[model samples]
Target: MTDSTKPTVLIVGGGIGGVALGMLLHKAGVPFEIYERATTVKPLGTAMNFNATTAVMMKQCGVYDEFMAVAKPFSAVQVGNTHRTIDYKIDFSEQEELFGAKGFIISRPDIYDLLVRQVPKEHFHLGKKVISSEQTNEGVILRFSDGTTAEGHILVGADGAYSSIRQHMYDQLKKEGRLPATDGEPLPFSSLCLVGQTKSLDPSVFPSLALDESQVMTVLIKDTPYACSIFTTKKNTVAWAVGEILDENRSKEGEKNEEWGPGAAEAMCQLSRDFPVISGGEKPLTMGDLIDWTDKDYITKVMLEEKVFETWYDGRIVLLGDACHKINPAGGAGATNAVHDAVTIANWIHALPPNPTKQEIESYFEEYKKERLPKAKEAYDSSRMFKSISSKSYLGWIAAVCFKHMPSWMNRTLLSSMMAYRPTVSFLPDAEDKGTVKPAHQHSLETRRILKERQEAATTAAVKA
Candidate 1:
């Protein structure tokens, strides 16, 4: 029972997903508002990458040129053990071969900044914590903790792993006996993530890093408490993250784990004692150096959690990003997948019929869930498998050997297949991308990568012919 004349969208959370979706909706000439719980938008979180799929979406959304300046696009990645031994290297260094496109390794906050800048400041409501939501025949009404209320045609939750909107949605379902089991505490935190950035370091300490203008390295520790380290550097500074397997410890007071506040920065640093990155130099480089270089304010320590839910929508309310599927940061796929969800949902909304009914909105929700649910699960599984392989155990041993012994060309080919790029929305035009240098072999890789699949009817017609 939405307004026949005006269609409005209310988006919760101002993270990558919400902001990205807002950008798309705005471009599509739809009216929308973004509510962010935080009073201020800050660039935080570990360094993340924008794979080809992400780049394609950004291009479709028309924001490629704006990011090339701040983003560092690299043609190679080096993965190995804690000792700095090279295992499987993805060297698309020769711009001739099509690795599709180099990934943009930018920090999380930077991405937020990029997205927020595009949207009008008036549309973004800061410090608006959505305490509850009510859906009626006309529209959905949102109540903020500040005792304010706002109504919109539909509510989209992009809040994060611990979503207040999701809780409200689940509460409604449980009250109706529709949800049998409680959503429960997040799929037990698989590991704890300790992330921070270092100040400028001299070239002499790590020559390869210095040579490449940026260094990307990962260390695998495969014992009982499995762990992995991701270290990336640009110019004088290095951004690093280390993952430690969390012991299954739950107290009588519910589930007990690491708390991310107060002295968290200090405690997270202490966990990196033996986790060293052995360089080609005589002395080994430890997390201690990076920890000391980074200010306590920049440290991010949290238990990494991942899950893909069975339920996505309840009536006029729908979920996106971490609200729908929480993923480990191992593959840098978390935010990328969230961006994908935003674009996919936005396109569906952009094409809605005039004065759409509640049933019409629910159909779009079903379509979104049908398409993105599987994508979320696929990305989640891939992230977990990669996270596990970053170990020193027998499985890790096999992975390391396969990576080290695997032919480089074959590795590159497998890398292409594993990326599993999703199609972009058909409505948006191609973004102006002057900065991306097309590789020579792009004829086989890049060109083939971007083409949309033929419609089912078209394929059927071809088969009959």
Candidate 2:
């Protein structure tokens, strides 16, 4: 692509979605820059899961091998009680046969490192927090905290739930009386989580680490507000998480605006350190044991919010991932959905014409929302469903029982619907469909195939001449 035709993209937020979008833009040869508020990237959070759909996307992005190297294939989730005995198991053994790929689990930092390595170091501008943003007829500009500026043809907010770009865009829209009431409302979170991964340890001590496949053991303390989960990753390190159900009416003031603040992590870790865990051992284990093995710097406390905004884009600025839809972490679809958002938006951006007008850009952004919003809403609901089963309320216990006794056929049908919408980059060759179940129709892929045929025909005619 010529420089004249390329639209320079400015991505705010260097998290999974932002970096993943950067990598996709890099593959398309589009000029882009990523601005992150933090001076350094730290490995934070717990385990992240990749279903078959996301695995296909990883393969398309040329990072699947690296991802697999640090990830373990996930087969089942065992829900246990205070006695260290599993109450029920959600088996995923049929995932390979059903989706043509095994689901994998990796630590959040490992995946982030894998993604950022794909993009050039020069593309990232660290410690440049976007204080505000503006857009005129020509392009968009971001004003940073350091009193500097960045100009680009388009601005993307991959900056998590409390996105600066979203705030700036919404402020302008509200002044113009275009912002929706729901969009203007504050993000509400009902649960808080403390998550971290242990340093690589001897597999002999942690028997779960010795297993080839991933094992997720979650222990729910009955009648208590606490739940603890442990997952074994590829590097012989165990990813651990402690969740506490918070009052919906809890004070929003003094809440850490940053997602991975260490102060909150440390406090929550101290409170839940004695929480019991089932670590594939004859003797009982506690979250404190894993905490002792983990680096304190990597621990994070995050408020799990659930919301999908009514307004996603206005003019040249748009939202992606948690910026627009904040899914509950309990569903395990947050990262996967964010990656989907990145891939879909990248396709639309690649389809943009040279020297495009604001109207044309807005049209493509609409197409992106049209394709992604429903999928995101579905994921949001699924995440909430999972969250309910872990709550301390009576409904939570009933939901858990229903889930445990749910018919196998019914469960498979529900999963199939969730897994059917695997999207790939339109500018790249489509990944071969290896599953028996046909995937849902993707507009970008359809356009990709049409363009490929036209390009091939043009090449053939030129050869004949």
Candidate 3:
């Protein structure tokens, strides 16, 4: 392409990450187009939590204020045993004082809408699934399942988990004898999730809900399944997701087929039986009583992990969001992390010297991988550990017991760490000194020392073992 011709960036999957990246690129005056396999965007999934980091990025992209207006913030998170409230609670007031911003809870579609509104309709081509793409010294060529073809300066595999682009890239490498094949492990925890909307909550009941409008409330039960319910918008509508740990082997191979389908409603009913909010369980819980057995299967296939890929980029093609790292909905990091990936990548691209060379583009991706890989792995491991701690087994019970008695300060510290986490990116200039706002407070020297000591201790323990 000539210098007069704007270099096109092809983005696959029009989800939150894809759209957010597109909007950022558009604002930076970069040429790009997004192709979504779906014919139209729908508010399909449940609720998500947005940490201060994600909220700040959204604000920079011009949707933070409007998005905040629609979401409700939970000022405190509660954990309980049977009917007794545990002392463990995340104090949002303290977090706000530390981070200088508040978190948000919003519907998946609300974020999608915010991103779509910023992009030109003509730039988006729906129903076009990417089949494969190849890169050359000049640019990249992409083929769609619809039999159309497009050429661009770069291709992004933001297609999400089960991404055809990722699969194709793997296939290409395998054909050239580059990678090894092995059985993929199922997630240690899997659950049947039921999600739907309900009427707005009474303010008198949930006084601690933070979202000005959309608030997510997660309640970790002592002996029963984990249940969470939250409002997604200012409208009186709420969405809830209930997870029950199942036999991983039985659940994956469909051995427990009878347990699914209609069993979803039964699952919620079981929640009421095991832990009744009226009897001191989490409050404002009505799904068990209001939902009908025939409530049309809203449950989706269980996920092993929020993310499926270990690496997110290859040559000129790259993956982001759900395509790269899928997080469990429990911690509300899924959507937030995805948006962070978009902003991070956009910033990396912006920081590139003017008219970067092909080797520089490749080097940029290398730096991206180095910076994001550890953070992605840490987030993934944290989610898995949290899920295991909330399961319905003997060990899970023991964990709950231990958690219940743990110091409230310890719990608060951990919760804050999860919310305030910022992935270490090697390429970006010092974000703070550069005048770019950060989501959390700067890491203290004491905290850094503690982290280093912990890393050393763990390394030594592993070596000894």
Candidates sorted by lDDT, best first: 2, 1, 3
Which predicted model would earn the best TM-score?
Answer: 2
Q: For residue 386, give model 2's deviation from the true position in Å.
A: 0.8
- Candidate 3 shows a clash count of 14
- Encode model 1's per-residue lDDT on 1-465: one tens digit a residue: 134554689999999999998998878778899999999765457677776667766767667767766666666557766556766764545322343445667766667788888798899999999888988867899999999999988889999988888889888888887864636444656677788766656757654555543456676653435354544544345678877655446322123544555786677678775677644466777777777877777777776777787778877788999997999887668988898888778866765665656777788778778777877887887677666566445765676667667776776665554454534654577543332333212111221222233245457889999
Candidate no. 1 TM-score: 0.84
Which scores greater on lDDT, model 1 or model 2? Answer: 2
TM-score between model 3 and native: 0.77
Taken over the whole model, the C-alpha lDDT of each candidate is: 0.70, 0.85, 0.60
List model 2 lDDT by residue over 1-465, tens digit each.
Answer: 367877899999999999999999999989999999999887788998888878778877777888899999988878888888888877777777787788898988889999999989999989989888999978999999999999999999999999999999999999999999999988887788888899998876787888899888778977688889888999999998888777655525326545345466777778887788777767667888899999988877777777899888877888999999999888789999999999988998887766778888898889889989999999988887777767857777787887789898877887787788888888877677688778787776555654567578879999999
lDDT tens per residue, model 3, 1-465: 123444568888888888888887887567789999998665666666676656445545556678877766655545444444444533454445545456666667666787789999988899997777888877788888889988887677787767777777777766777644531333333555656544454434434332353433445555455554434355544565656666746456442456556465555555543342321234544445323321344433343445446656666777787776766665566777776677667655644444555676667666666656666766777676656555756775565666656675776566556656543232223233121233343221122354456568879999999
Error of 1 at 336 (Å): 0.7
Give lDDT for model 3: 0.60
RMSD of each: 6.7, 2.9, 9.9
* Per-candidate TM-score against the hidden true structure: 0.84, 0.94, 0.77
The better candidate by TM-score, 1 or 3, is 1
